[model samples]
Target: MHGPDSLVFKSDRPWPNARLRVGAIVGHATSDSVRLWLRTGGPGRFTLLLYDCGEAMGSSSVRAELRAALGRVPVSAEEAAEALAASRTVPFEVDGYADDTTRVLDLADLRPDTRYGYALHSEDDGGKVILGHNRLRSFRTPPGEDERRPFQVALFSCHMPYRVSGLFRKRTDVGDIDAWDFLAATLDRHRDDLDVVIAGGDQCYSDGVGTLDIWKLLNRSMRREGGELLPDERSMRSWYRDIYRGYWGFEGVRRVFDAYPTYMIWDDHEIGDGWGSHYLADDGPDDGLARVLPDLADRGLTRDDGRRLLRRMFRAACAVYREYQHSHNPPTDAGADPDADADADAERDATGADTDAQDVWDYSFTRGGAAFYVLDGRGHRDIERDGYRILGEPQFRRFEAWADALDPEETPFMFVVSAVPVLHARSALANADLAAPVRAAGIGDDLRDSWEHDLHDEERAALMEVLFRAARRGLRPLIVSGDVHCSAVFSLTDDDGHRVWQLTSSAVTYHVPRALGWALRFGAADDGETPEGYAFRRLALYTGTSYALIEVNPAAREAWFKLYGKQIVEEPGPDRGRRAVPLSHSVAKIRLS
Candidate 1:
């Protein structure tokens, strides 16, 4: 709000009157809570709102029954870890200086393998409930690894700002329009065939698309085809919420997350464009990815500022995500020490499942009879070896432990990693996209190095060394990723001498560039590689936006990638018409065989 005396006031006091929006997320679960999160655009006295199904899990409208089940919880991202550790629930205070706010509501003492329904609300100054209320929502905890039930997941990444309109927006159908639901449909159709979906980051973009304001009018006009646009942080929040709501508010997506299960690892967009913990030399501690946006900006997860917030929020997100699934959900009341599960961790290691002796802690999940270890590629790095680093020493230690725990055939492990494409085969190495002055300028310094620089032979080989571990051990490896915009595939050689596989699906809604896309399709019109330096050794020629549907058999040591064929899938035959032309459905049995 602007006034003579009052400088700039960013508050949720006025809902539609301002840009503060609400973002809700449900991913990777834990015992007590469902990993519930939301953004508050800016700062003020924010209330932790939860809708009471009042009952248990089921087909129930939970709005009316959800009374003032509100907690006077007050908290912020700046609070000391000690404070966060000690408090049960604190009132959330919105920081309106910038255009963001995010908080994780840890609903402890929940039941395992049960579904809990919920919704969000915001009340500034502890005055009145001004934000979302009674909007039906829910999540399920995971069934323990030994629960005897099979596992499944919904692996996704690069979920973006506008699928409704353009420059940055995509031309997607309702099936694709509601991308999350589309993913849910995929999970639904193949519910029995999968365990969980692993999201490999770039889940949302902030520095992308000028601002959220322009995105709003642009979306409203998708149907209207025209509208007066005013893009800014405030507009961005609502636009962002609308975009996220498209995913979470869907029946299919919500049901799957609530029934099946999922795990997410952050990339640049989760916080903002080109964000890194300390990747940038000049960025302030609260720089690009570190700068806080409203929970609305991040759709209620981690903002685009940096990894610190995500690290803070990861434990929280895991809670809700696990609670929604029958698997992974821990008992909230007390005594169900996740430590109890940790108790057998050593035994798993002894069984020759977890194989490393490195002193580091990392996370791994079990589903579909497979173990997915998310090795962080962005923040934690020891980039001192020949100018490039492997999964760093600490993370590498964690990997060794994870590998030792895998029995090759028992629970065949698929490393659902963010950056495990351990090869660099670029045939085309020339050309530049002066694309449009605007785009060339937009991508500017922010993306040039990323898009322009291809991995040198040295770095590629080093990555392969680390990658060889998974292969040498007779494990079929699968890589899920987002940072790059188009869907592509890579091949890896296992230790047992079998050729493993790596699959990459680009931005769910983001694009590299029309010029880059063209270069990606064919070679550079002028040079063989194009203006950007990337080259594809086995770059399968395909087009349109896409994601991946991965299938793995830990026992068989077999894995395959299913590209969204209807959109980009290319293999066509009579049966193909019956099925769909999968863009990159290359399949190969994996083993150290």
Candidate 2:
């Protein structure tokens, strides 16, 4: 493979020409179209050759015809050059300035419930040949809106990439396996298991370990009063892009993405820890993660200064999210072509003082007999003093409208995906006597980040009230989440007899700290008695890395939540060879009434 033109090589890393650094089918998947994302080692024109798998296989002389028509569709190194030259292609040109691009190709009036095969090719801008081509990749169009059949969804989140710029640290004494080994293994083992994949949050930790050095943490004297220990706008953007490139570069993770369409949202770590939790000057001082460089706030900036900085950082991070994650399953409000420009405009508008956390990542879509709602919990957080609203008023109003419009009788199952658990042990800690003492010590203010925080009682109750309204209307809500570094399921029922269930899985790669891990296990255990038919069931809790699979059988009115654990296992050898194992727990099946 030859390299891109000399000018093109200046910006991007050097790589064999035409070979992709990363590729995936992203953005919203409709009956007719899906977005394809690709990044090349160098500048080139990417072309896709699409073929209906069914039609090709149905031919009387499949082998002879395909060979004659497309010349054997070579996958081996020897035959690839010939096959690529003969391949019929659809061109997607990379700008001379950029090597990464996303092309949304129409499926040419594709049929529903059908599989299609696509081969990727690349060439120089002048139609000259380049390097190795992508082998045949295939994806199936989802069933039409009226169709009813069983389907599965894979839910996982919180990937802290290993040793990237030394941001995420691990012990070298023992085997420190990546949790994604389990995710990749699950995708390999359960090849046909899920139709779609949903990543809850913390996909990439931009301001993770390596970003904040000890010098920044200790030396407040030499810095600008209100300036944060953060990168400037340009550096911020570059960091976000690098984080995605490094994290998704893994072949194992890439394979799952290639096989399934993924939908994602961002958490606080996307920008900085506990983002959008700002304190007004009149509200006294900041605390915990909310307390940034206060001297920066004191440096003649307005009370909205923190929020302004947050919005700036968010704008940069949101750019990458729009390109890689939100593009796949954007909010219903975003128009058909949800490009980066549209997202930037929306981010600017949503970043106003009235808006708490800016950037809109909430979205909804339906499949089978169920409707799925992905909530942007991190983006819409109001000040703890401002009634501690978790999802700002605008987001709540949108959710209310969507929920009210749904016919619960027709769509019996309602699935809500929140980055943080809506029902969990956090609620149990609301009334616990820890706040005053903790705050007096000038620490632990980040506890208010949860939905169940005491300051957010009214906010939590309001959200519950709206969800209850949906439950009364006959929609059985199942809230799924993946933060907090632990996995569990809790049942919630109010006095009015409305019942909802919460399932949580977290830390696809990040390991919980020992102190927090012990406390979670000790306090959040499931009591045997289903008191008042409301119970907190500790299905499983591991400080180590894991993921979950949710399978729904629409015909049977049942769903199964399967959790898989990934860990380093010692092989039977004198050297004690170690390997990563992603083994699933016994399936916990539930019947929906």
Candidate 3:
């Protein structure tokens, strides 16, 4: 029941000065380095103390030590004090311009496959720690690249926090169990086994601009006489910040973020529902927000005015997104140096087909024997101005280079993350021509948001060709995705047996309606062939709130995937009304070799 303003301490030593409410989130991690994101009450200097548990400790022992450090177990005062006195101290500062309350601390030069407990404390002007009560959290560094370690990762997305109508104060969705609560419980039960957690997309929905009070005001303002007097960039930034803080402040969600080295990428909902998939002009038939607000023109808002407002909203969204999500992700080439190659970057931008590496949100990283490339599907999408592109030319070129440079002997496995599924069901309803009509009915943008849509055919072909080429070179390329509100597996196999797989798990917290579930199942029930003559088939489909666990055993050249969620029982039996039981179903097991 703890809110954003509440602080949970690891001990009850009664420290009156420990009043600052802070949130510690473990960000991207490597064998020797890890990033810690902290959100404090306000801007100030702080010291982070990291204590490494001895290498002799086993996984079970490490967990015990962490529990004892958190005051969950009985530990003598002598042991606790000794551990704290032997910690490594690092000082950092947070400032107002950078969103006063948040800062990211990068710690490097740590041992691989090591467990470490950490605590954050506020400091006085004299450089002395002032916080008396602190919360101790811990994370384990991944095994080094040279090590052949068997690791498991959890992947899921579409986290819609339980929302209440701001005007009515009532629930908007079904009430069962919180998905984050289930995920936190699962993490606790298998803490030692899970190495990383990937939140594929839709970490928080900005549908209707969010559920906060400011968002409600914005919604009402949109329906006013002009519908053009929207919140300024500053006001929009504060509202978006409130949305993130409110949504992620739940105890279970906080626990999951703090417990693991989690990575994330943005999808459409992170900006607005179907942000990049529709026409931008208000007068166009396929216009997105115009369709949502059909009377904008009648309300005295011109097409140009609407377009300007959309651009403003986009700017605000990107500003807040960088501060909350992208800051902790690995930096892009252009982002590393904004001034580097300015002339070249400007030349590329003039073509409307190029993007600076920094402007693009795409990033890649490696763990052990596998490499991951997270695509910025929404960030650079341009269906209208560019005549259709999911990943702009520059970002796609970067992806091609990454794939071409991979040495199969050293890294045989590659995971391509497209927040949206690349090979989902193919249906006529998803055609681009039907976008206007579909959107008029309130679901058009979603139908057009797929890789199979006609608008993205060329780009999808290019992406698939690169993956196929990688597979031909003996690299097992697997695409993992979310945002479909269902769990499914698909594969493309050529005559020579060069195969590529796609795994999708989504709606970690949001529920999929029954009719939509049936539609998804029916659409994915068939097999087809790509234009390149490669056979593609849907292997499995589960429509529910679920997450996928992938276990990679590099030594054996094998990987196994398991989807965990509640299974539906159709039979009218005694178990029909019984308590829901979470079950793990084997989805796929593939050989990297």
- Two-way TM-score contest, 1 vs 2, winner: 2
By lDDT rank, best first, the candidates go 3, 2, 1
Write candidate 1's Cα lDDT for 339-439 as tens digits: 21222332432343322223122367666456677755544332223343434655665566666667666565566575423321132223233345425
On lDDT, the candidate that comes out on top is 3
Among these predictions, the greatest TM-score belongs to 3
Give the Cα-based TM-score of candidate 2 against the true structure. Answer: 0.76
lDDT of each: 0.42, 0.57, 0.66
Q: Which should have the higher lDDT, number 2 or number 3?
A: 3
Worst 10 residues of 3 by lDDT: 1-10
Across 1-593, the per-residue lDDT of candidate 3 in tens digits comes to: 22122112223312212222468778889989898877766666667767765654446765565445534223333344454663577767766444637777888998888778776656444333222223346788888888777888789888764544446643343234456776777676667667778889988766522333333334445422332244344445555665566556566677788878888898987777677787776455666766544555765666555554455455556766776777777765422221223233233333433232248688899888888899998877866755437788888999999999998878878999999888774632333454454435555466577787777778888898999999999888999999878888888888888999988898787742423334454456457786567787766777767787888876677887777776544546766664454433433444333
- lDDT-wise, the better of 1 and 3 is 3
TM-score to native of every candidate shown: 0.54, 0.76, 0.80
Model 2 Cα lDDT, one tens digit per residue, 333-424 = 43112233323433553456222134567888877677888888766565643654677777777887888788865677788888878666
TM-score of 3: 0.80
The candidate with the higher TM-score, 1 or 3, is 3
